[model samples]
Target: MSAPMTPDAALARLRQYGERTSTWSTATYNDGTEKALHGIALTLAAELEQYRALELGTAEGRVSAKCERAEHPVWLRDLDDVRGCPWCELDRVRAELAALPTPPEPQIPTCISCGATGGPLRPTGDRYPSGAQQFVCSTSCTGVTS
Candidate 1:
């Protein structure tokens, strides 16, 4: 098999995927309207969560035959790898998220309930004082304050 990817390298792949999907929302079917990209965005979000978990020591790291293929070697954290692989630094997580490209269209509003910025948009009955459209990213955010 090919060499295993380092945690940062794996994050890079995820970043590329997210950036590419940002452009996918612009694609149209035979109807000629922009395609809905909720699914793709959700998938990216899930992957991001998974990576975050790995970095936090909340999830098991990669299993290797001789532990040589593991990314972010577990032993580097202590004199004898005491705590196992070190938790992913918060800076690395932020950097990974920042590396993703901005979506081609205007960004959707953050979910009032979860504060998530990217997801399916749900219409809010109220509009801005200027009459511009208003929407929340998650449907479950209905009664929450933005």
Candidate 2:
């Protein structure tokens, strides 16, 4: 058997069937032929819809794979539509993430009055050799017992 006709071709055939049926001027309507034409039109319409859905599904699947590799959110939609597409949303998110500024490394103040490092130190409003504010390891390091 020959391969099935494409949806577009089938749709064209359906249109021609419509034109032929419309030209029928007999009082005795060929009910079978008219019904067959309607059936063919509906079949062509359904075929076109299925074809579109397959295409959209393929595109969305590709986007999902890309999202996975990029460690991005995959909001998958099976519908054959472009409105509010998850792939576009994810691309937007990626752009926003790329534009974000990374936080600076925290500066850990060290005691200038004592040899202790990373201890309970407090700033003394004095600049150390590193230009950072001077800190004392403790009150005892500042010569104060309390």
Candidate 3:
């Protein structure tokens, strides 16, 4: 499929900078830049879906072509959708796990200092640093015990 944005189209648009900007102190280029930032974020989101689909080896030529034409949240949604999806087979393990019973909870370790109850245990899935165990604050989220 075609790229998300054509470099030539971007360069062509950039050639009109002063002409577009000269219309006002902040023209389409200025306001467009802020809007472009948000636009690009959405574009990247869509691309991520396509990339994932492509990686899973399930994305069809038609689907990949459609992804090339897609924009914003709609493409994002389609990419995330699993309806008649080529990669639905990837869900088997996850679906089985979700159907299983919950395991016994791990014991919460209390904080010796301040006699604080252990607030939380950081899971491996947490966005914490590698090998870092984040203890939830005894008082509040911002409260970190030294």
Candidate 4:
């Protein structure tokens, strides 16, 4: 069997057929050929309309391929389509978390004399030599015994 005719080809053929049949006598109108031609023309017209609709839909889809983020291509109708986007939501969450104040770090007690943070430390009762009430890791740090 022959392949089906494309819309363009069918339209061209139909135009040629119309041109040829225009000169036919009124007696020929009673024959089944004109009726069959009329049916084919109606069917072709419907198919052509469907084909044009599909082509227009494809063009619109291509135009709307990119989202507002611009990070990647997405099947969205417009740039303002962030409500349904996972990437946009993630960015919003990250920004919200970043805007929050961070907790302060804990202060570790260190000996003032030797600047020693680790090991056992004892506080000297007398505020002499360094002035401020100081903690010493060992007796060797200051003359005043710990």
Please identify which of the two predictions, 1 or 3, would achieve the higher lDDT against the true structure: 1
Instruction: Tell me each candidate's TM-score.
Output: 0.22, 0.28, 0.23, 0.29
lDDT-sorted candidate list, best first: 4, 2, 1, 3
Instruction: Estimate the lDDT of model 1.
Output: 0.53
Tell me model 3's lDDT, rounded to 2 decimals: 0.45
Compared with the true structure, the alpha-carbon lDDT of candidate 2 equals 0.60
Backbone clashes in candidate 1 total 2
Q: Considering lDDT, which of the candidate structures 1 and 2 is the better prediction for this target?
A: 2
lDDT of 1 at 85: 27
lDDT of 4 by residue, 23-128 (tens): 5556656887676776677677667766665545453443234447777545434334435566666778999998988643224545656666675778767553
Q: After best superposition, candidate 4 residue 32: deviation in angstroms?
A: 2.7
